[model samples]
Target: MNWFWFLLFSFTSAFVLTALLRRYALCKSLIDMPNDRSSHSIPTPRGGGVAVVVTFLVALSVLLFKQLIPVDLFLSAIGAGAFVAVIGFMDDHGHIAARWRLLGHFAAAIWALCWIGGLAPISVFGEHVNLGWLGSILAAFFLVWMLNLFNFMDGIDGIASIEVITACLGACVLYALGDADHLVWPALLLASSTAGFLLWNFPQARIFMGDAGSGFLGIILGIVTLHAAWTSFMFFWGWLILLGVFIVDASLTLFRRLIRGEKVYEAHRSHAYQVASRRYRRHWPVTVVVGGINLLWLLPIAVCVTWYGLDGVIGLSLAYLPLVLLAIKYEAGQAEAG
Candidate 1:
């Protein structure tokens, strides 16, 4: 079957699987209990993301088997995705220590770095940076950070799904613009699977993506963006622009928490989206606004970076400056104070 039909299959599989996972979670009494730190008030079955993971991996593996994707990239993405999904699944069912989760994240990041042959020397506005060994180390850290920040931003009902769709579609567009069709298939598949999850997850919550789901999305996005950058280092920032919504909120919130001398490891309802959700007293509108910003503010920047071969530093700043203010205005790190 062509990848296009597989897109529909992935979406249908995710939707059906999400419903099944929700039932299994409810029957098994595996639920997320709402608390001071939580964004939801009612307990909902988590780990619906397992559906997303299974469908995406299965679809991607089929492509690999068909020799449709590069062998090294296929291995790295699936291997890293599987590793992080396991840790996240374990954390969802039984609490895994943060340190252990971090270790797993780093291990997965390193595996991908090895496969990608490390970060290629990058072009930053015509200035060259040769990272060498340091490039791989930095790339590993970048992957882990993306993995964890994605988890951090998965606070509201539909925000994570929105982020996944927006970023995936944006990546697809950028890749196509570059004539880098090799990378488009995985991104498109991810968007479709997440879209399936979104049907149940959005507008109202029926089930949550748990860590398994969100972590899988995170690791895969990291790998996809890495592949983008590997193809053309200029594309590193293009991927960043495409994902600016989650990237800005999560990165700034973490920075604020760190500066405030707060324990960053503890889950808190302090992300910008969380603050907005609390303000509106609903999740969907905030999710919608985020999607709006992604399409309105970020996608164009990504297009510019892809087509013009220009440094996205300006686009990155144009995109993030407002979000930084929103984070500050929302008092993103003041969950304890609030």
Candidate 2:
């Protein structure tokens, strides 16, 4: 597959562009100013994710122009990504309300559902269950939820970018193993772009993803994972296992918020990553923790697609372990401090 050069090129291109654009955003006032909910002390360039969007869309467009992908799926996926990116960009600059973000997400979801022609309810060990129209609706909601979760999780330096890179690496490995060819390109493109953003973001914060980048990335990665899941029962587990970090942190936090009667829709710096970042009084430590988990831990599971053939849709559900522990510890610490 000649993936050696491809991977190298994707990573290098994304990193350089991300670093340069980040500096440009800072000079041009495309920065996220410090506020109450922000952990960053200084004004940082926002929307460095434009580099991600550019690399992904441009690469995908070239592939499409050369007739490399299936016409229907390629166009639909790219269209949805572009649509969401515009909405996110507006929100980043204009601080658009939540309602508007939901509207755009819903619209993009419906577009994806139409593009994918509905999801097939997947069971790994049991019989495959198709929920018919209900499945499509549920899939849309799940996609939107994933998108928002990714956006929410981007509150700290390198968290979202690292997660995105992990997801891409997972997809790329699967692709190299002949799991799914179509899913690999988009994932690698986004992953490489994240490499670019992380250079400035990690160690010391210089720029942030803002809503534009995080939301767009979440939606793009969400759709790619959805596409992989529909490939078969085995592929579904691969995608889920890849997303363990994001789903666990976001799902548990939302559950906690719901239980506490907190305003779930409002912005709050209460995510486990946020809590750890604040508690530790450093951003890179939390960033390194996530990266370490992804590299040392999650990467092992991701390799399961190539090694043990552990692709049951339910097996990947076990990816919640670290999340449960981290959440419980973080919550307990918060209580203890109070």
Candidate 3:
């Protein structure tokens, strides 16, 4: 089968599955009710992300069977991805204590790291430096952080879906430019899967991604990033640049909340994008802007780092500077204004 067909299958499967999931959510009363920290006003069906997860994983298996993806990478994606997705699915259906969830997240991270052969040496100032076991530890924490930040950023309608689509598509282009064609399938398939879900998730969402979808995307992206790093340190930097928006906003918000002596684990709507959504009295505009930034701004920098021999660290700093300013401009991590 042509790879294009796989992409089509992924998109169609997700689209059909999302519609079915929404109906199921309605039937089961699996709804997200508005609260003080909630982004949407109306109670809506949640857990629509399960469709994306199912579509991507099934697509990944097909790719593996066709020998399009390496066995190690496939195992990593399936084992770690399914583990986190199951955890998130359970949490979405009910409650999982924060501590237990965190533990499960870490376990999943370690599982992925083991399968991916731990973190690769990174490029800094044009030099490859290995962090040894410290790098492994940091990579595990990074995976966990990515998982949680994705969940944190999924506050408003379409934002998370948009981010995943843009970021994954952006990464696909980078892989093509870098001549790492083998690395392109997973990212492209992920984007296709998310694109299908986005149809239902855009502003005035009929269904929400919920924990299962967000966490699955987070850990999967993290694993893909680490796997790409092994191919070229520049690819690692490129992926970081590609994901700058979510990383910067979520990290900055958590930092500021922690500084203010707030319980960082508690949910709040202080994220820059969340604030922007509320201020604009709409969600699509915010989501659209995010997509624009990824494609127009970040994608070029990622290309430079991956294809033009730009120093990875320098490229990362350049990519993040404006984003950091944007976060500050939106008062990211600050307390909600009364």
Candidate 4:
């Protein structure tokens, strides 16, 4: 019952805050103008993701005050996520060099690792493997990559918001199925927060999430994945499966661009989702398709892994195979067609 109110509070706070932020962004001329490398044509207000960050963090702080969550989880989510969000917010206001931004991302990853006790042992092919110190390094890089990929994937209307909502809600269900009730509230709250923001971001978007919101969500989700691994390594594979769409699309595009000697940091509309949106001549279809994929395709695989003892590596491969094919079909990393 208490958790229900928390979820409601999170949703209402994010909804009202996003509305206020939209007005503020317009007044301050913080609008994202369309360009050759952009997805949207008409200029729209951005930085509305600040509402999600604020609402989620406030709810998290309250949970901490009530001792409803562990201190390490609180620090990892709040401390590291705040660092990512602050840097992202600053970058949204003015240009920040990619190098500095990457450095800050690494720093935040380290903070999260320090509090969360580094990467927990992970299951691989029915055997638990502890990577020891090497795990820490890999986890740090993983966190950085997750945050960056999220930033890259937040190109179209409501896609990023929808991804977060579905992924988090899926995770909450996994936790409940595994009887890890303590883990459900945080994930539920995150979904609720993003759901409120989606109202303003879906289809013809009235506002954008900007780097602040997307990057914060990336690191926070990564942290949640790690935290869940501490409880059950299979849950890590579940998360990896749940986030398969973004992970597969962003990673494939990035690697392909790197191989072609393209400067990956510069913005471009070559992602699978972006190309699909252009092909469909609307953003809503692509967004809706992503949501459909999450609910219908990925969620069941995640449940199988997290609750049914499916081998983590095999499960991930099963989950990613079709997505990889889809990325290729969409020309995820290819140059935009004329």
Candidate 5:
């Protein structure tokens, strides 16, 4: 299987399909209209995520038919992704109960855990920690956590796309260094497709990912990280660093919502990205800032994965320090200013 061919096909197919589907979604009135609680003020076409779904399914299907990747992992990940996509589409079209959505998330997570093998124990700084029977449970929880984080962070235009691209680049770099096969193609495919989608999703957005795009991308990235972790220690550390931005922002936002009188489970436009977008008065800048940090800073730290082995863990820790401080300061400022 030539990866070059696969990457080209993934990019070309996804871009073409996104353009065509964007028109279709608009024609069908599958759009997200601005609301009092929305960061976006204009009604934009939604469900372009069907492009992401179709692209990943097609490329992965070809690979599976040719036996280029593991059938269980490939099929199971798609199933989980599709499950979330369905629920997201439902939410985009109409109101969906939180409990029902949470139930779907749990079902997808369990499927991923059962099919993708349990999480590999972490052996850091010469200390071994075997999760034993608990590994499967953690693995399932990780899947659900990542899915929710990505979904939560999808408010602003182009933010989620850029984050996913940054993560895929980090994954690709590690795979290149180690010549890792299990994760390389999937990461590249995801990055290319997301890049194509970002064209219309940036400032003055033309379309929204809705829950379908964000949730499915989340599932794909989470599963890819797990697959990478199983392959090598370098892959594991790199995935953590790649995802730190989203993790910190989403976790802090949720915590603050809890602190406030707001219902944590309800929808709100209080994410750091949403706040920054309103303050900065431009969507593209926030998107660019995130992409820059991930590409310029996080990607470099991910490269350290190859050398010093797990010794480069400190770099990962340092990379997240600024993001943590930003989250804290941002939340505080929001409270005072509001």
Candidate 6:
């Protein structure tokens, strides 16, 4: 019942499940082929995220059953995460209509919030702001966006896995520092499980996570942020700061696409990290660079935000400003195939 044991089991489970899924995908022809919009150069077995999700959920349920996590938190996260993963799994093997995906995302978001007891007054820069009727609507939008952005950033090898590890570790750090030990286990489990996947995903990816894994991560993380905010309003800022890399890249790229009259829903490799990967002609460097930024740059800034409970908005902007500039420098505004 100790966390370390659970962590080890989760990690090993994910690693073994990934291997099995890879072979299954190969046999099933579940492969992702390189295309004009893709970042990879060869067909690779995909749907590895299913292993990640299944292992994660199984571990999470054990923790919940043991009363390590609250009933509501467990229920909300499990319910929504499983549903989103199913949608993603379906999408990974074949095509799913955009509208249906959107609807599923909205439903999952609402399902989580409903179980988690809905959104409270949100904060910006240590100031309390109320959303009233618009709260649910905006929260749904944010949840959907978070899930989709993870999908967007999952283009290159190991990036999504790296980001999840960083954020989950950040959550553990913040909780430990704040003396909220009860909240640390979920983050620890998530980080370690993803690390198991990262071993096979990085350097040279043997398998891709597909839509199922990426979308599952997004929903879980979105719920995590909301739950953290509920725990301490300042915690949301810390969580966001931890996720700054993907948030900035995805948001900036989407904004640029909207400005340039591009279809926002279409596939493209124009994200900031994607641009950097193209520039370097490899995925590792960009992945390392972003991982470094999360650790060296954002982590310290996030600690300040979570610790100070003041100037979170300012700290967040300060943390993101450089990433935005870097995206611009790399011409993330331009469409790939330009």
Better of 2 and 6 by TM-score: 6
1-338, model 1: which lDDT tens digit per residue?
A: 57667889999998999989989999999888898888898888888999988898898889898877888888898899999999998898899998989999999999988887878787777787888999888888889888888889888888899998988888888888888888888888899999999988888888888888887888788888777787887678888887887887888889888998888999888888888898989988999998898888888877887787657787688878887888888877665563
Error of 3 at 119 (Å): 0.8
Cα deviation of 113, candidate 6, in Å: 0.5
lDDT per prediction?
A: 0.85, 0.74, 0.92, 0.92, 0.79, 0.87
**What residue runs in model 6 are displaced by over 4 Å at the alpha carbon?**
none
TM-score attained by model 4: 0.98
TM-score of each predicted structure versus truth: 0.97, 0.89, 0.98, 0.98, 0.93, 0.97
lDDT accuracy of residue 132 in candidate 5: 67
Name the TM-score of candidate 6. 0.97
Residue lDDT tens for model 2, 1-338: 46566556666776777778777776778877787777778877887777777777777776677666556567667877888888888877787788888998999988987887666676656567888899888889987988899887888878888888877887677666755676666677678767876787787767787777787888777677667666655565666677777777788888877877877787777777888888899888887788777767766676674447664643565556766788777762132242
The global Cα lDDT (0 to 1) of model 3 is 0.92
Error of 2 at 11 (Å): 4.5
Candidate 4 CA-lDDT value? 0.92
By lDDT, the better pick of 2 and 6 is 6
| Cα shift from native, residue 86, model 5 (Å) | 1.3
Q: Any residue pairs clashing in model 2, and if so which?
A: 15-196
Mind giving the per-residue lDDT tens digits that candidate 5 earns over 1-338?
Answer: 78777777787777778889789887888877788678887788887776787798788888788777787778677889889889988887888999999899989988877777768776576566778669778878788888888888888888999899888887777787787755677787888888778777876578787788888999888887777677775577788888888988988887777777677676677778888888888788988899898888877877775554645457677778888887776562144343
Clashing residue pairs, backbone N/CA/C < 3 A, model 4: none
Task: Give candidate 2's root-mean-square deviation (CA, Å).
Answer: 2.7
Q: Model 6, 282: alpha-carbon shift in Å?
A: 1.0
